[model samples]
Target chain A: MQIDWFTFGAQIVNFLILIGLLKRFLYGPILDAMDRRQASIRDRIAEAESKQEEAEQEAEKYRSLQSAFEAHRAERMQAVEEDAEARRHELLARAREDVEYLEAQWREAIERDRADFLHTVSERAVTETIQLTRRVLDDLADVDLEDQLVTVFLGHLQNPEDALAKKLIDAFEDADAEVTIRSAYELSDDQRERLLEVLEKRAGHSLTLSTVTDRELGLGVEVQVANRTVGWTIDQYIEQLLDEMLRQLEADLDQRLTADVSATGSMASVRHR
Target chain B: MEISPDQIVYWEWRFVTVNATLVYSWVVIVLLGAGAWFITRNLTVGPDISRWQNGLEVLVGQILTQIETTGLRHPKRYLPFIGTLFIFIVTCNILAVVPGYVAPTASVTTPIALAMCVFVAVPVYGIMNRGLKAYFKRYIRPTPLMLPFTIIGEISRTVALGIRLFGNMMSGNLIVAILLSLAPLLFPVAMQAFGLLIGVIQAYVFAVLALVYIASGARAHQNNGEPAPGDAEPSSAV
Candidate 1:
């Protein structure tokens, strides 16, 4: 076997050229692509890590804001509850005051109604009693009763007390003074003359007497001289008895009303408690 | 039968001649260069790559790994020279299975030329990595008196590298030829299959040896503080 220098030289040249060709086409581009891919992968990883970090930070910020918001909401809720509680208490107080005012007005109206009813009852009772008494006396009255009332009036005139004699003398000093005799029934002429004579003797001067029939006198006689009146009549006794009865009835009604009011006040106080 | 493709002259001039070795070398070169250009024309930086690009990457990656395995720290700097050697040699050997195709590595001249390239690249890389003085100083390492032996060892190893590849490739082809004449069918086919395996192995051996030699040269001075070339494991079993 022989070695060919020319072929050897050419092969060496061919191998060198092949090296250059492979380096340019294969090694250079492939290696560069791999390097670029590696660099890109590294950069992508770094960018992903950075984004993750940023996301974590943002999440933390949001968490903090949420925490603050929760705290603020809790605080506001507490304040609102407190305010609502205060408002409720204020409204309750106003309602209580309104109830108290309405109760007081109701009690006052009840008392006023009671007073009006009592006054109406008292007036009616007094009027009815007086009317009944007057009717009874009128039914019972006759000439005798009238004569008796006149006799009683004459007796009071004839037997006058010291104070009555003075008041009678002073009243007769008026020369123009006249005596008016009023009776529930008509007086006879004899009875009128007697009544006049008795009044004249009591006065120690001659008196001018005038007789009148007054049905409201109720079997009684009254003698009026000037502005003084001196007579004994059933009307006086009846008036005194009516006045005592009215006073007793009024006292009874007042005591009953006071007891009722006290009872109502005690009940109202229990309800308030 | 011609034992080497160099014997098959296609054309001859006074001092220059075109032979089968030259012709087939050109064919391998063109096929590799065209294939590389075609596959790498649209290389993507993404994970999705074409099958041909994948194949080329595997081939180039294997070469880079082998270079690195030779204790060369920076394997990329020597990728062009060493990677091309592996690609050209392996391609020539693997293509031997095809009909009427002669492996250029079977010729003594081609392996010698390849070994010469490695021989020249060793000192070039050595000087480039270390200074020129520091690189040449490795020749007389341990003593100046051993300089001639060291020089002889360097030359002898280079020759041995060339001869080792040439002998293996040539012997396999010669055995296939001799077996074809005696038992042309089964033995020749089986021997050809064996030859195919031997061819690929020889290519790998040749490239790995070249890488180790270059690495040794480049890191010769630096090996003083690190693992010397002798102490480092061989790149391949061969």
Candidate 2:
């Protein structure tokens, strides 16, 4: 057996070249690509994580905003309810005032109508009584009541105790114009002279006297001085009696209305007097 | 039939001779170089790999793992030398099944040349790792009296490595050739199959032994102050 030095040397060189070629092409490139792929995977994972974090934050922000909106809505609802309540009370008060005013106006209108009716009745009754008195005196006495009224009026002028007559006399004394006496019948010359003497004596002054026949005076006499007239008539007594009766009726109506209002506790129950 | 390729001389000169061993060894080397260049030319660094590339990667990866399992770190550093040894021996032995092909490993010349490479590499690595003085100092460790025995052991193991491979390959070829003349049919075929198996085994054995030797020498300094087993145990009877 023999060894070939040159052949062994050549084999060693061939193996070394093979090693160089394998290292460069095979090991180096494969390892580098694997590293790059791994790096890319890691980057993708990191980016996904970041996106998830941002999404979570956005969700949290939306949640907080929703909570705030809900709270604001609740506050507005409460305010609206309070406003509605206040408006309801204001409307109620205004309605009550309107009711009370309308009730007062109604009561005043009722009282005015009652007063007008009572005045009409009382005036009619007084007129009828006066007419009856005048008729009865005319029918019972065959004497003229006009002459009698004239005589009585002359007699009152002579007496100092007659208040109406005294007032007339004073007026006559103060008169700058002529004094006139009007009656329902013509007076005789003797009666006229008598009336003139008594008036002058009571007055203690000289005065011009005039006489008039006024049938509208009925059984009354009127004496005038300086556009002033004083008269005594049955109509006056009828008016006084009517006034007293009206006062009594008004007091009775007021007491009944008070009692009815207290009993029913309703102002609507009041009726016309 | 020749038992050793070195006996078949093609030409002769004053101090240079051309023989079957030289020719076959060159042939294996050329095949290895051309194959490596072709396979690695379009090597991809991505997942979409060719079948041939896949095979090479698996082969290289297994070789690296085997060297690492021998307690050797940096398997890549020793891969070129050890891997080349495996490929050359395996190709030379298995190609013997061809009618005209004489396996280079069946010759004492080829085995001795490979063993001498290992022998030279062991000290070179030891000296590189532990420095020149420390590498030589390992022979007389624990006593000065062991120097002669250590030298003799080294020389004897180198000679044994060359003889071991040459003997196994030559004997298998010789037995099969003789059996071919005697029992021409079944036994020779069976023997050739067995020989193929033996050839692959020897390839593994030689590669592993080269790795062990280099690992021991290179890592001797870092063995926690313990001595390295510079002489590895025989992996096969041959």
Candidate 3:
């Protein structure tokens, strides 16, 4: 068959157009869809990885907080136990000091009572003996018997203050004080009567003067009241010394306790973080 | 054996009459023209069409599908040339059987003209796609020294296309003609069957080569990342 050039060329053009149309409409969409789907899958995979990282960080944070809480609880428990031990020690020391004080006071009281009973017995015996002797030998017993009996009763009344003076002297043997009489020679009648009355009252018995002398004021009428002396003499110096020592010790203890409390508070704050 | 009183002058290059071949080529032109009109005016993506147009579509669609599979990076660009070549060659080939008709491809002029058109069109398409410098740079691979040989080789091969088709068809025609003239009826049928088979194969070979040539030419200029000839490695598209 013969093919004219014009007709052949035209046919060729038509076929070309058909092929181009099919490609543009159908094949192009398929390729574009395929590329888009690939990119989307990649994006999804990346997103999942990022989310997984965030989850892991959250889990780590939870674990860290739990461990920190446990450590803080352990620290607080230790502090509580230490505080309980210190309190126990403080109570034990206080109990021991109180028992020692009470024992000392009871011993001092028993000694004082024994001395008083002895002095009272001696006075009664001396008085009774003098009366018996006077009845037996009536002519020689008048003024001499009265003077001797007065001496004996006054000596008995003075014994308790003397014992108190000795106790004060022993206690102050290592301390600084001067023993002396504030007033000795010039006693008014009321002062003498009041002195006798107060001495008798403090000693727990009635007293008589051995002599009308003033030299015994060196002891300053030392007498016991409620396991303590109440006169202005050398014994008061020991009381002042003891009170100062106790006050200084208590102030030191207060400072230490304050420091401990402050330290514990700051430590607790550190543990909180 | 008888000499008639008046007769048309016969120009035979060996066994083919030049005038007869010319007349047959004209007839092919006319037939293709009518087919083109029937196709162009009524083109549709829908299913309804005359059997002729439908048949043409099926043929064109099948060839387009194959060309697309070459994974031609720019199948669209080369589609017109290759598609037209396919359709024209197929029509001319089948027309050889149209009683009292001869295939234009069975003549030298037609196949030569077709091969020349491809030879010219391919380079032109190549140059257009990639400017002149880049198009010429394609021949140097698998190395530069082979360029002279390759250029000559390409030209000869395209020329050989014309010679090959002309020789084969003319030989087949002559042999069948001699047989029919001798036997008057009996042996011509067998020879004609052989002619049809040869015609169809040559047509197919011509079309396929045209496709591959267009594919190669367009493909070379395609810096679009298609696998080179020996590198026809398949890959997932997406």
Relative to the unseen true structure, what is the C-alpha lDDT of residue A151 in candidate 3, on a scale of 0 to 100? 40
Q: Considering summed lDDT, which 10 consecutive residues are worst modelled in model 3 chain B?
A: B1-10
TM-scores of all predicted structures: 0.73, 0.58, 0.40
- Please give, as one word, the docking class of candidate 1: medium
Cα lDDT tens digits, model 1, B1-238, are 9899988888999969998899899999999999888988998877788898888778778888877777777889999998888889888988888889999999999999999999999899989999889888888777789789877877888888999899998898889888888887888888888888888888877778877788888877886624365434265545
Task: List model 1 lDDT by residue over A89-178, tens digit each.
Answer: 889877876686578668867876887688678867887887798778779999988787777666666666755456666777774547
A171, model 2: CA deviation in Å?
7.5
Tens digits of per-residue lDDT for model 3 on B61-177? 566577787666565566556655655566666665567556656656567667777678767876776778877787876578878976886788778776667677767667766
| Model 2 CAPRI quality | incorrect
State the displacement of the C-alpha of residue A82, model 2, in Å, after optimal TM-score superposition: 16
Give Cα distance to truth, residue A119, candidate 1, Å: 8.4
**Model 3 Cα displacement at A28 (Å)?**
18
Task: List, residue by residue over A1-273, the lDDT tens digit for candidate 2.
Answer: 555575456445544554565456544443344446568678888999999999999999999999999999999999999999999988987777677657766776666667668766866776687668767754543226656776777777767888877788668665774779887678778878887787677667766888898766666677787878877765566567767766776686667566644544355334210
So what's the TM-score on candidate 1?
Answer: 0.73
CAPRI verdict on model 3?
incorrect
Task: Give a tens-digit lDDT track for model 3, residues A141-192.
Answer: 3334434433443354456566544454344344332222133234345544
lDDT of 2 by residue, B156-181 (tens): 87787777888889888999989989
- Error (Å) of candidate 2 at residue B89 is 4.9
Per-model TM-score (chain A alone): 0.56, 0.57, 0.31
Any residue pairs clashing in model 2, and if so which?
A: none
